[model samples]
Target chain A: MTDETIRDVLTRRGLSRRAFLQVCASVTAALALSPAEAADMTKRLETAERPTVIYLSYQECTGCLESLTRSFSPGIASLIFNDISLAYNDTLQAAAGQAAETAKDTAMKNAWGKYVLVVDGSVPLAQNGAYCAVAGRSAVSDLKRAAGGAAAVVAVGTCAAFGGLPYAAPNPTGAVPVSEIVRDRPVINISGCPPIAEVITGVILYYTTFGVPALDHLHRPMNFYGNTIHDRCYRRPFYDRGMFAKTFDDEGARQGWCLFELGCKGPITHNACPTTKWNGGTSYPIESGHPCLGCSEPGFWDKGGFYKALSTPTGHWSRTGVVSGAVAAGVAAGLSTAAVARARQGRAQKKAASADSEPKNPTS
Target chain B: MPLSRGVIPIRPVTAGAPAGGALADAILAEIASALHEYLDTRQNHVIDLTGMPLSREDRQRIDAYLGQGEVSMDIHALVHSHIEETAYAGVWRVRHYDMGGGVHSERIEIIDVPEIVRASSADMAHSARRIEALRAEEGA
Candidate 1:
């Protein structure tokens, strides 16, 4: 079947055992697995057959492909791409026209019930699915056909996952996500304008290693898309201190203050951008002096002016006010508990002394 | 009494943050929380440090911050390791060695009791049976 294990591939490439283990550890950590699971993951990846992945593109800008290919440090291409058998990708595959379709079909037929169907971009279904086509066939038709025999369907970007930019208002083509088309199969969404390169590879590696990872309410991997960007942002301390950058060129901006006032959607956006960063732990949008556009979240394009702060009631308290109120309440509770404990200690000591001083009874 | 060994230079443990100390601090804070979890509910946590891109100097800096505790144990199993409890109780540092005696993997493990020190139940049972058999043979 020409299936090669990860260890065999690594050894053929002259990669050290340590390097292989490191990749295993990285993927394990990305999946939020315990350290013990890393060793198990390494063993699994060592002997496990590489799964066949059929990547289908619809109405995307190819930014996700760029992110996956152009990512710098940790070298995701070498780490992840070398391990998987990418059966079909229009952008990457050498085959053209009928040959490409034949290749995809051949792979699909060979890996039936085991292959992974990864869809990028949105599928248009406005006029009998006429907006996009592959091999003169509608995108919806192709997606349904591809997803039918696949083991799992992975929505690669915001486009395929949530109908992305094309699915925005005034829908002319009536773009719909892959999930809408593939109703029977489980769709794992890795959503982002152009999702983090490592994250994309991480999710793929996780599925290839573990059966199906634990996902969030949004059908995104919990480990990567679990926490809000604001919760993990380094500038969160500045936000809590109520120190915000009023303008892009303001003094606060120079001092690396919070971007909440400048319309940062970090509080509402869930992503690993703050921690994972982009370009191999270099920096993310907030660190590069830009307010988060909340790209990863659904309907981000319609989330009222990127420069406008989130609207709130006039009397609504700020985050600082809530923090201060909680602090005060905690201090009052602490003092009351301390006072009660001290009183109890005093009474116990008094009783002990009183008993000690009492006359002793003689025993025969 | 004459000094038997040469004077060993003691490096001063500085209180101020060093370069890349913030990253280490973040990791330490995570380990601290894991320690709290262990103490509160007796849940064990194993934090793999092998995946992180930590330089030798960065590791030394983190080690300096962790300091040392009274208890340290060296284990020589299929893979050799040096396990130590950090200054903070229930927080541990476990370093596994490769065949070449170099560190293969390092982890920050949090548990109520270190796993390496605990004997396996199966081994304990086997030893109990062996001792009883020996006593029976000796008629004692």
Candidate 2:
């Protein structure tokens, strides 16, 4: 609450100066900046002010917050997210009811026009925004008031970034992403079913260090989302060698071949899961013997079967078979891959229907 | 059980890019270029090894190529770190390990010494003050 620098807080809070440098080095490397920037960043961050952050949840599972906070494998670098966060989320904060509401209001008022607004989940506009309410107030109104004085809006998950699962076909609640409402303030979308932990931290650290980062057309930070899973995939050589895994238990599957034939959307999806990885760089989905679900991309829940390959028909490879995701969006119209997508989608629909029909009441 | 697709008899690669050597060669080439740029411009470069798709064989090739230098040290902080200078003078390898002993972030730097090794000015000042207080208490 005082006018102390970030380093002062870190030191006073028992985080060593060297540990702070380590964090700076890790983030600098993650940003793909020169190694020298580590020292420069270390110096700058020592004097940099810790910005106030306010987290707002609209319509989401707490998975995005779970991703940000590391319970499985806690590391000092990830803990930096907590050091600067003046977060007022009901889930993590102790206060509730009027006390919690008062704290959030007071914090926002004091840090108004200066706090970083981090929002997750989509905001439903249907039913007069009655689908989701906090303290008897609609999520839409809460979001509008909070965003009114925010320095910047950080959309954490696909729900907040691109109206995730709730915004799928039929969209019962008429869910709209944060960018749709907070258009006045600059919105940084970190879209994922739950984005990579480091990517979220990396984006925030980059913002605190050097204003807003360079964004792609999706308004996502270009540094982390620049390369697709297909681009940096370790199985890429297998793909280029024309060795494809047809099923989950095929010989090629045992041989660590490309899973493009098994419905991998890596060809058209952009994310840093391949690089930053999960569970602390242990392994990603593709490496763990599963095709990419493209969970980070928009409309991922509505996308076809997770096991359908993203390639053309058998025998020969076409131009559309191996196009980069950046260009794949425009080229999807005439591609034969679309047919496979539709067929797999039908199979997926059937599977969902059968599952839904299963007895919900075990006694019945 | 009825199989989906015809199980094509997979054969050894008798065609395109050489297996195992391609990625290692690419990394080696990157290091070589980075080393040259460092020598010529006195600029430092870092290649994030963990981010790359390096197999066991690729790792062996890179390890054998770089070898090991005389200077190697372990740093303990929030995360344990092992840093080793490669046989090449200006090239160094940095491995940051999580508390769980899994490799978190690994990279190669073409610098005099990795920045993480250096003591920060704040720490140095603290050290000086602490020692000064100790000496004064002893009436030296």
Candidate 3:
């Protein structure tokens, strides 16, 4: 199977075999795949025919694309574009005007029922979808046309997955996500304001190897987005000690205490920010002394103020209150008794010493 | 040396809010009364006591109790009020106390009945162990 030999493919791409192996290792760790599974994936990825991907951009700032381009180690961008046959990308494609549209048409026709549709922005549905038009076609029309025969659709950012800022309050454009438009196909939502770069590449690698990565109810990869940020927050000990940062630069904040009172969305927000971090896993919002804005979860924009504390149930404390009071009282009493006893012992020791030193033998 | 001591105010720690009419109000009143008793006893102990260093066992017991959230302890009245207003459906007043030569205050709020009892029971067990340790230390 010429397609199965990844080592040969990398050599063909002018990348050393060692560099290709390193990429494979990174993909395995990023996807949390076992070593054996990773080896299998490496084999499959090296040899499989490069899948076609069509990328569409709509109402967005292109931050997601920018984040993707910033993938640090071994440069995932070069690997993705060079290894995969990315047929159409509005931002990166050489063709434009009639040529670009015709290129998209030809790719879809040739790779029908095989291509992967990747969307990076939200589609505005208001005013008969006149809010966002590409090549004189509404975003909704463009998306539907692209999705009709694609094997899968990957929503690459918060905008493409949940309408992000475009769908924030008022939503002048009446923006909707690609999933709403492409209901017929399997739509995977890789949600984040601009998701972690590693996570984005990891998802692509999983799809490239295993056909499709396991997804959560929200269509996010379960391995990465399953746990809340609070579960792995470094300052959890301070929170347990009841130390919280009340203000931006208060003593607690300076001490690197829990940011719960400072409107940290870690407890409620589900993402790998605490674990995966940002800027090549160097630091996340919480670690840098700022509270999480929960940019990854759906409807985060509408979920009250960013600094407001979540209405967590205090029921975990009913028993705690009584038990702690009694314990405190008992311990206090016991400590007092011990101190009194120790004081008495010291006094007695001094008396004995005085008695021994008395001049009773002075007459002798 | 600065004394590591604090005072806590006494407050009624009721469980949940009143449901609707007279029955709910009565239940709330009952819970408040029980919480008041617990707080009053604890305060009396604090007042009668003088400069005594807390033991490691005592601190551990207090930690265990706090973990259960059956009672809320604060070093300042402001923190107490905040806990009472935000965490519990009850009222409380701050009281100051002298610790050795230093002075500090705490706000003491009663947790709901069931949780308080459970926590208190665990605390009592811890206290028994501490009391035994104190007895041994005195003998030595």
lDDT of 1 at A226: 62
lDDT of 1 by residue, A1-364 (tens): 2466665666566544544555564466555555655656767787676767888999999999888877663343445663456777889878899998998889888878777788999999888989999889999999888998788888988998888899887668999888778878678999999998778777776667665555655677766776667766767767767888999987778777888778877776668887667765567899899999878877677655788775422233322342233223323443332344335434544553465353221100
Report the poorest 10 consecutive residues by lDDT, candidate 2 chain A: A314-323
Ranking by TM-score: 2, 1, 3
**Deviating ranges (above 4 Å) for candidate 1:** A1-3, A14-16, A74-76, A312-364, B1-63, B66-140
Model 2 per-residue lDDT at A337 = 34
Q: In candidate 3, how many Å is residue B62 off? A: 35
Inter-residue clash pairs, candidate 1: none
Task: Give the C-alpha miss distance for residue A12 in model 3, angstroms.
Answer: 0.7
Instruction: Give the number of the best model, judged by TM-score.
Output: 2
CA displacement after TM-score superposition, residue B103 of candidate 3 (Å): 52
State each model's CA lDDT, in order: 0.70, 0.74, 0.61
Docking class of 1: incorrect
Which of the numbered candidates is closest to the native, going by highest lDDT?
2
Error of 3 at A205 (Å): 1.4
TM-score of each: 0.67, 0.82, 0.60
